[model samples]
Target chain A: MEIKTRQFKAVARQELNNPNSRIFLDLLPVVLSSLRQLAMASFPDPEAAQRLGGIIRAEALSRLPELLEQFEKNALKAGAKVFWAGDAHAANAYILELARNNQVDFVTKGKSMVTEEMGINEVLEKNGIEVYETDLGEFIAQLLKRPPFHIVGPAANVPPPEIRDIFIEKGIMENPTVDPRELGYAARLYLRDRFSRMKMGITGINFAVAETGTIINVENEGNIRFNKSSPKIQVSVMTLEKVIPNLKDAMHMLRLVSRNCTGQHIGAYASMDTGPRKKDEMDGPDELHIIILDNGRTRLYQNVKTRQALQCIRCGGCLNICPVFGIIGGFPYGWVYSGPMGQLLTPLLLGLSGCHDHIWACTGCGACKANCPAGIDHPRVLHYLREMEVQGEKSLDAVPPPFTEDMAYKAFSVIASNPTLWKLTSKIIRTVLNRNAQDGKLSKGPGPLETWLAGRDFPQMGDKTFHERWKEIENNPPKAVLEN
Target chain B: MKTVSLFVPCIVDLFLPDIGEAMARLLKRLGLSLVYHDAQTCCGQPAFHGGRNPEAVKLAKRFIEIFENDETIVCPSGSCVVMVKKHYPELLADDPAWLKRAQAVAERIFELSEFIVDIMGIADVGASFSGKVAYHESCQLSRELGVVEQPKTLIRAVNGTELVPLNGAAVCCGFGGHFSVTYADISEALVKEKAVHYIASKADLLVISEPGCFLNINGYLSRNHPEHKAMHIAEFLAGKQN
Candidate 1:
């Protein structure tokens, strides 16, 4: 995928102006969040259930190496081929080679963000191998050549009229209809043909259970099940963090992810593949290959602060509650991941320098943190990322913040730490800010305040600041007291 | 009478000192002795949010040194209290002495409503507003500090002030310190929606606990819908009218 993370502000502004995007953005969070609230009510203790999900993710990430090894060993024992790819290039190359060796003209894919991260479809297409996105939303997103608007619904924000136009253009539908069901049936029929004829299928592993050496994929549309069952050769790609200690943990995560993602008790299909089809089996893949991709995750795990990001189960819960994501949708994130997840992951995967806008475009609202099922402290992580960006990190390819900002903060620190300097500076700042004031309000201003003043009015700095008035207020009873 | 040290945040100190005065007035009426630490400047929120950790550390130490000895501390801004109570310890983690002080100060500090309703066990502060009012839950105060019910309790206690429902009241008003300016467009969108909700609630006044939120929401209301008013909880509870 093209990296447009640097265009965050431009894209975000564009999204904000888009009325079509606004309708979806407003409805998505409210609907999904309320549904999530209802679904979570099923738990005896929702908070504890959420906390346990966090614990599971933390444990899995902390014991990541051991869990990955155990998963590989068990997967190999179960007659599945396991390949470890250090990066996206390696992962894509392995998948491309596998497709070529199988003599397959095309491969059907079950919605996999990791595959998008690896740019697998682009690679396969460039190599003349057709790749069909079996997931209905993903199929629309792919045909439209756009990034996923939301994690759960790639084309969810894309309006029906737009989908109808794209479906017609892609020859998926003969009749032009804005109805979602009709569009969906057209996609199903189109994808179904590919599913039946495809020799190879690729999917993303939701949970790679080390206890049973089974790879699990959960989906509502049954496309992932078909991807697992119809093909002779099946390839499942997983990030190392996907490996859990046991099936019980996987079940626990399934409960969390389902409720958090789409507010479902459970996805329609929870297909698990231990390995290839047995000799006695009538159907299922003849070859089962699992590729474990690192792709900057190992480096992310090296730092204690960054490692917490790996705990995310990609439930899109954060997106549903994030005010920033609610306003701008997903395109501004300019990568495979969007919302708080994108803010946390993109900076780590893509260098901080390139992802400057992506990281800083948050309100530091803890809604994402409070809502995350995986227990990722997004605001804290974002703060850490901001620190790294300001200070610069060699390993992460981060450059130090601009000289002006650096100096501004330095001056701010000096003034803020000393009361006398603070008072003096406050007076100077007040006079300058109030220069254009009318009726004790500055309707517009220059510099950083320009943007704020564009849409809102700022109060003129108080004539008598709190510090200056304390002496008088202390000696006299409060007005409320005097009134009584 | 319990003595409460006032940690007036920089925003309240400069932009909205009325909030600080209101807080002082409300506390004084409740029979709490208020001590204003004039030497205190900031809680290092701007520096911390700007990723200037060293500068934030300096300000944090300054804050700790000034208020560490107080029996109890209260502030009008939840985000500032969060800065001292939550981020300060993490920022000072490398320095044991400062971290210890930060942790101690963290416990002693409380947001105004939290201090009044929770610690002081006084919900009715002898305040009243004869109109329907909706409370805007600031992000850090509500979620980070979990100080939701305390402010609402105080609002409900006010004579004739109906605590009306505010749709998406807990959603951010988008004054994320520097975020309002840097990502101004997105911030504007959010604050606009907040104003929309506030207007739709038909509440005579919208009350907020945090001054940052007050500046943002009131700033928008001032420009776009000058008639629609929002007040800090301090001012509202202090019986000050907009």
Candidate 2:
């Protein structure tokens, strides 16, 4: 996806500051932190955690291929048709064709990050099918026509009064009130009618089981259940990497996923099945379709340092702890996922153009890496990505324009290789910049460093380097040592 | 006793020469033979991090030439020591000779606190300071280098210097090598958050190993909030001023 830099950030910034996000995040931190504390408190012993973590990793990795196959089988078994998309354009075309096939005049979708990346809504809407976002947070974002600032908490930055204002304008709510529960209930009621009647329901998968070819959806709101169960034709869309080997793996992932995301032992519902509803079941769609998208996961899987990004359960721990992510917020990430995962995924999924603007944003602090259950060395991966950017290597997107940075790096190689030049630079620094007298401090400077001296008092440079100062003291000293 | 080589980081070589002298005196007092390699300039941190690979490799090879025979290499800066241990191998991947040398360099490199604890086997340096001192754990040193408790252990040796734990001890202070300028807005916010924690702790001095964090948090607090002051660990210990 070729994204214009400032335009993309503007959409993100607007979404973050939007009322829904403020309300959501303000309320979310208290809930999230409390839940995290509870989760940590209830955590199994270290030995048990290690065992569970191992199983989870094995479950996800082993089931990847078989899950793809099973999902294909179940999707085909359902009365609804399925399509294979190797890339973004293919997925968009496939969804477009599916809309045309269903004769879908209007489609209602729960927030699917996968679809957002594929530009599915835009594609379907451009083809004259009206797309309505049914998720509460999503509905708010759509009212203003912007991308979500967060993956799970689309409305994290939005506060209640502004949301009430937006709702008042959109004619969803009667007036502003201080109650969030009532607000959530209002959104639930408003979205229910569309959920019941939409011809097709679109949803993203939390996990796809390879054993039974089942797609599992985790939700607290019951909207997902409605999206999956109520529509005549339900289309489950997921990135190919979502596949897991079996039921056991799916359960293990669920343990971490539920706890990490919302601080539950499990989400309220873990709706699971390989195909359409069972013969005995009265509820659930008659036809169930699943579309698995590659979107560059295969390429990413081949790299060692980065492949662990797939192991993300979409838990946002890294974001909460990340100083950059916490302070700057998510919009600057320029894509669906944010924080550590985005730094890894954006480059691999959308390519370098979107990634470079961010890949450097990381401080190599390893907060994300430490907190990550998958043990992804996020800072290391970020550093490697930056290296890839500098080398003009095109894993994705355009190699930076030759005029952009090649000359600077070329000059660096020449300057670094020569001892004399290196010595000269150091000499100039010591003579001009380091010439000083007070308790080892630089009193003044010129050129680029003039600004540095403007506010903060400068530290003095030593007349001779430590090694030189030491060598002179021991070798031939009537010399007054630079006293400590 | 084992012989040790000193790799005073390039910045210390130029700016904080007293820290180097203090370290040398402290080591000499401890009775270990010291080899100071003059040929050493940098651990190739700036060049390697900047993606000038060949230059970094050339410097690494030069480093190996200068200090290949030393039994152990110690540096006061956790950040540079980590860079040398981690990034050096990537720099010399195509060359087997340098790869072996790179691994050898990594195997022996130690941060000052770790060298004191592991090599010297001394929990506290018989030093003294008065008033409250909050230790700032630089991320690379504490996390990557796993030297979290070393500074605390050393601080306990000093009489009258009470160690106060800084809030959000594990969070970065936004001194991520080019991160300070690249994401200045976030960096400023992070530093301010840290300053609040410092002020709340009501400590007389903030002690740190990594210069980046020292300058960043110190710079922010000194300018905007004058009630607090920051000092690097070396300066704090060597200055002997509470």
Deviation in Å, model 1, residue A376 alpha carbon: 0.5
Q: lDDT of all predictions, in order shown?
A: 0.90, 0.71
If you superpose only chain B onto the true chain B, what TM-score does each candidate give?
Answer: 0.98, 0.91
lDDT score for residue A271 of model 1: 88
Please estimate how well model 2 matches the true structure, expressed as its whole-model Cα lDDT. 0.71
| Candidate 2 residue lDDT tens string, B42-115 | 66776666655666777777777777788898888998888778778777877898899888888988888788
Look at candidate 2 and tell me the lDDT of residue B189. Answer: 61
Q: What is the C-alpha RMSD of each candidate to the true structure, in Å?
A: 1.3, 3.9
The prediction achieving the highest lDDT against the true structure is: 1
TM-score for all predictions? 0.98, 0.89
- Docking level for model 2: acceptable
For candidate 2, write residues A61-136 as lDDT tens digits.
5456766777677556644356677888887786677778888788888767788888887788778988888777
- For candidate 2, give the DockQ: 0.47
Q: In candidate 1, which residue ranges exceed 4 Å CA deviation?
A: A481-484
In the range A28-58, model 1's lDDT, one tens digit per residue, is: 6689889999999999999999999999999
